[model samples]
Target: MKQYALLVLLTGLLSTTSQGQQALTREPPLVSPEIHDNHSVTFRLKAPTATTATMSGNWMRSEGFARPSATMQKGADGIWSYTTDVLSPEFYTYSFTVDGLRAIDPNNAHVIRDVANVSNALLIDGEFANLYKVNDVPHGSVSRRWYNSPGNTKRRRITIYTPSGYEMGKETYPVLYLMHGIGGDEEAWMGLGRASQILDNLIAQGKAKPMIVVMTNGNVSQDAAPGEGSDGYTKPSFMLPQTMDGKFEETFGDILTFVDNNYRTRKTKAGRAIAGLSMGGYHTAYISQNYPNTFDYMGLFSPALNNKPEDHPQSLAYQKLDLKLKKQMDNGYKLYWVAVGRDDVPILLAGIGDFRKKMDTIGMTYEFKETDGGHTWPNWRKYLTEFAQKIF
Candidate 1:
């Protein structure tokens, strides 16, 4: 027994020594994204066996549904590196293509998913991008809560952002129902949109009011996002069922009920706001008009308001639009904000022009903002930032 115990002790010491040596000999982590003072960024990857390497990023112009890529040069030390020209201060996503295979920066853990693609996230902070950063301010609390959705016959996930000091105070705050695009889920606003950071910064700067921002999954067919639902780890698609068919707009009451019941919200039209991007903007329009008196402030960010097929059930929501708009206007609203990019898709531009003409014919007052850029996250973020400040 003594010999056995002695042998065990020797084995333990040998294992510890081996682990220590291994730890000491391990290669140091490479800094793939090295942001310089001049705002240029250096990206590096260690791929000695790779025949070719290239970096594709959202910063580059899109070439027929594909992002432009830059060639990366390899060094004698088995590391491929590329330095970008002085990039604009913004949040960008990038991926590396090595030997014909797409790859994310293995060294950078800051990754985000957009529809089916996953890429590494990089923030070049200076001007507007600074609003997307987590500044030293009283930060709000973001919670991922499941709410019972009777319309979908399942519990769905919703992300809520209660402003700072919400839990400690008994004061009731206004609510902003911020919806995501067709391809996005509840996590979209919190991740890509940087809603919390934008809100926190604006509130801290006294530029915007403190309110509860609720982000819901606009895809009513699915209860939750890809991995968060019962359907395990399925790949997300750009298009999903019942996205723009008015099903989500019909069932929006479930979300309102859940939020108002659980949170300290002012449940009045004057204290409620609804906004969204792309498909979400369509939802905002329908929900505001259908409900008539639920929300006072409405923001449409590059909305997809193209006319639907007359035979489709979705067209029911679009029918009698003038009557609905008249009723909504009669009901009284504080702000109806419509923002679109000057370079957005031609279809969207045509739709917006038609909608504006209709509004003009009916004498419905609204604030129209035309900005530079196409339908992208940068425009969406800018819209949110500007719209939040205007609302309660």
Candidate 2:
């Protein structure tokens, strides 16, 4: 009787499999976000009865996730489809809203997280994005490294990227401490920015030097980013407490020491680079200033500037920062790069202008660039591509 029952179960499983195959033959699978050779993308959804459908993404002319960039047209087959004009090569996140409900792309499985927003990913391979894409080049290895943070009250997780030849070679490499903005964690660069792939392609193409890139969770109070660790300290808040209060610098030296001791690092200031985006830019500004002799290369991508009167050059805070900047300049450094998008927030633009004026007044030489986009990942990734090539 048991054998008969088992046979019945196996027959049911095979029958179900056959039915699924038959259904597939009757209805073809929908191919969404199909990219053409010209970089145009076509998106489709199998919503036969939906009254309306719209698509929104970061690649749209307007920023943020609230606005719909394209409208979908219903076809005779009850499928809604929309095709975009020729787009540049880059990674983009978008979603479809059927009627009044926003939903992820059912056809595309590659999704990306931006703070609290989750959207389906679209990749159009071209110049820089090709660098971001996984080409035939030798790739690097990335791993999560947990270390005790003396500054924070918990152990922190950092994402480390080792170049392709790192495992077999005995040579020491330079270290670039990469950072993300507010609401981001150690995985931000690797996830949204595609840092590891960019570096791998750059190194393979002889565009960037072989270096170990360390991405740290800039949130001081949190041990790691959301859902990244077993610890219960992964909550992210809008207040940005640790960074605003200057707590990130307190235990930064410990992280540096750990990296130097554990990894095959150059063990010198000249071989170190520190850079970040937005809030991370704020940290970079202070970290490079507080520890002038630590990093020989400093990059600020859309750096958050304190534009208050009290933060001006004549103010106490500005005076101290000025002194450190002078010290770093005198000690000799490889590069001091500040880049921002032309369409960035007006206040940020004002801040960057003020900072540039101060640097000019102090006779502090540095490079400044204003790119095409606003305060978004596209600009940040472009900045990294350029900055990494310029650094040692």
Off by over 4 Å in 1: 1-12, 15-25, 63-65, 307-311, 314-316
lDDT of 1 by residue, 1-392 (tens): 99999999999999999999999999978998999999899999999999999999878866334567999999999999999999999999999999999999999999999888899999999898999999999999999999999987889999999999999999999999999987899999988899999999999999999999999999987878999988889899899988887778778999999999999999999899999999999889888988899999999999888744233555556577678989998888999999998878888888888888888887899999999878788889999999999998
**Cα lDDT, model 2, residue 192:** 88
Steric clash pairs (candidate 2): none
Q: Please, what is the whole-model Cα lDDT of each candidate in the order they appear? A: 0.91, 0.84
The C-alpha stretches of model 2 lying farther than 4 A from their native spots are 1-26, 63-68, 230-239, 306-319
Cα-based TM-score, every candidate: 0.93, 0.90
Specify the highest-lDDT model's number.
1
Candidate 1 colliding pairs: none
TM-score of 1: 0.93
